[model samples]
Target: MAYIFLDESGHLYTQIIGEILEMYTPTTDLDFRVFCDQRHLKGITRAQFKEMLRTRLLPLLPKGAILQIEMIDSTTNANIQIADWITGALAKYLEKQKWGEEYYSILKNNIIGEGKELFKDYWVEAKTNKKLESK
Candidate 1:
């Protein structure tokens, strides 16, 4: 049997099932928008969130487990804070896997940049094709 943990926000959660470690910001919570609106006001920054995740997930995670982190899709949630948290989590996971700091930094930047570029391209294409109604 695998272990799973969830935070109060419900958006942030982690699970270790079999050989895979999964972390994600789930999109199904009805109160997620309200939760996001109150994010930093509660003094819970991305750093703190990352630490909380590590504290809960690390002990349960076995060595050589594959980490699968679900980053916020720009099309659905454009919150930069969530993106930052995902990047930080990725760095920690990569380090734990002994992938080296240099590789972590490179992957982090690519993650951040790739999403933005994809959103921009999608937006331009939609506009050009008149798929999105313009005001």
Candidate 2:
């Protein structure tokens, strides 16, 4: 049995299943424009936008899901300027937003940091597999 921890940013979804992981970053502006146009927002607020994302995400997620969504306050930090630049570029190119600093921090601090031991274990396993293949 495998416990898959799923995460998403903008319209792109990432899935990490066992040792294999896949990420899809859409490459067309039309795709995002179509999505935005189809959403048919009647003056939708930011909160509504977030809620819509959560609702769409919920059904695709596994049962008893452990999901976290953090919104970074762009008004308070210099990092947000960098984030805005990234998002603006993405918006121009793909019509989507990238993960902001808060989410990035969560990944760096929580997932990656806590999973260091697991990463080390995988590193060892990978080395062992390579050695076996060479022998």
Candidate 3:
């Protein structure tokens, strides 16, 4: 899992969704299902949220690719709950909170990349991806 510093960003949903989606190759006839934890969105409607995802995702797909995105309450999903717990632990660890290292160490092996700042290399990388997609 990649650790992204998302603090006070209104576009947190996109970041989480995009990061997960970018992990896979967009192949023909691909059916990608992404489950996101529902949160109170400030400005956009739920429909707009889904559409925004499709806007970003569809460009990566070829002729025929199916993308399924669902926003569900975290309470109803055990997998989401585990993810939330892990996120919380990692956030605390990154923030250097009490017992952060101890908790982070438990799941250290699962972490892929650490210290990824959202504002720094993300946009550059996204542009690079777009360029790669065109070629």
Candidate 4:
């Protein structure tokens, strides 16, 4: 399973890169130090970030791959604003991509009501299956 933690800075592009990097290289296992550089959150609009994620990152995933997205609302930051914008934009994008109903159903069935332990189990199971299938 691929885990993506998203946040926004001055420009959406930089925000995407920063967060993705942090996820791949964390400071400590429990450090929770990942953050977008706020200085980059100046002039860029959220719409641009959403479009970039859809056009760029979305295509990189294999067809039929499932994506689980989560946002960290840290300390009343502007990143929250960007996150909200991105969330809405993503919903719209998913609909346009014709993946709305199916994706939401999966999240509701597996992750939400069932609790995070189940989510983790599902993620691990999915990842293991993907790895085996690719072998």
Candidate maximizing TM-score: 3
Q: Candidate 3, residues 28-127: lDDT per residue as tens digits?
A: 6577777878887655576777887788788888757778989888899999888899989988997799989988999898878855345567667988
Worst 10 residues of 3 by lDDT: 1-10
User: What tens digits encode model 1's per-residue C-alpha lDDT throughout 59-116?
Assistant: 5555544333233434466585665556666657644755556556666666532221
Candidate 1 accuracy as lDDT: 0.42
- Candidate 1 error regions (>4 Å): 1-41, 66-135
- Candidate 2: tens digits of C-alpha lDDT, residues 1-135: 432323323222211211211111122222211122112223444455556555545454556554344345556556766657554653444323355444444444433222212344776798899999999
Q: Tell me the TM-score of each prediction against the true structure.
A: 0.24, 0.30, 0.70, 0.28
**lDDT winner:** 3
Per-candidate clashes, comma-separated:
0, 0, 0, 5
The models' CA-based lDDT, in order, is 0.42, 0.40, 0.75, 0.47
**Total residue pair clashes for candidate 2:** 0
Error (Å) of candidate 4 at residue 133 is: 57
lDDT of 4 by residue, 1-135 (tens): 233334423454544453464343322233222343233234555445444444444444556544333334544678767655455555755446576565555545543342112233766798899999999
- How far is each candidate from the true structure, as Cα RMSD in Å? 15.8, 15.3, 10.2, 17.5
What's the lDDT for residue 53 in model 4? 44
Off by over 4 Å in 4: 1-9, 12-40, 68-71, 76-135
Q: Is candidate 2 or candidate 3 better by lDDT?
A: 3
